[model samples]
Target: MQQIILQPQTPDELRLVKQFAKVMKIKATTIKETPKARKKREILDGIERGLAEIKLHQEGKITLKTAQQVLDEL
Candidate 1:
């Protein structure tokens, strides 16, 4: 048996997929993210945002917060 992964972006899409799976007699399951998985995803997202901001700063399109300013915000 082969496994398929589907990531529906909206509720409507998810419902449609579920309906299709049901009609096809396929077992569909929802995987919930654990706290650790959620944290890791958040960290990775932050890193991506930071890298984008750094790129914008290098391009002189936006100014980034100084290390002291970031510390103060924290």
Candidate 2:
């Protein structure tokens, strides 16, 4: 499986592609980026979230039968 990105030249073209995707039943979605001004803060926030999850698992707040279950999901 592969992903593609499109930076439409104009709003009209963007709308056309969006509408076409919807009509064709394709699972298309928008990705809003972290503004440059807060990019560092956003990266740190994501790191904290991951660390928190790891801590929970380490503290026995969660259990895993196998990591394969998570890898297979991807």
Please provide TM-scores, in order, for all candidate models, with all chains considered together.
Answer: 0.59, 0.41
Cα lDDT tens digits for candidate 2, 17-72: 89988999987887655688369867898999988988999999987556898888
Model 1: how far is 65 from its true place, Å? 2.4
User: After superposing candidate 1, which stretches have Cα over 4 Å from the reference?
Assistant: 1-27, 71-74
Model 2, 30: alpha-carbon shift in Å?
Answer: 29
lDDT for model 2 comes to: 0.82
Worst 10 residues of 2 by lDDT: 29-38
Reference-based lDDT, residue 28, model 2: 88
Q: List where candidate 2 sits over 4 angstroms from the true fold.
A: 1-34, 64-67
- Check candidate 2 and list the clashing pairs: none
| RMSD list, candidates in order | 3.3, 13.3
Tens-place lDDT per residue, model 1, 1-74, is 99998878799998999999999999999887799998998999999998999999999999887889999988
Per candidate, the number of residue pairs that clash is: 0, 0
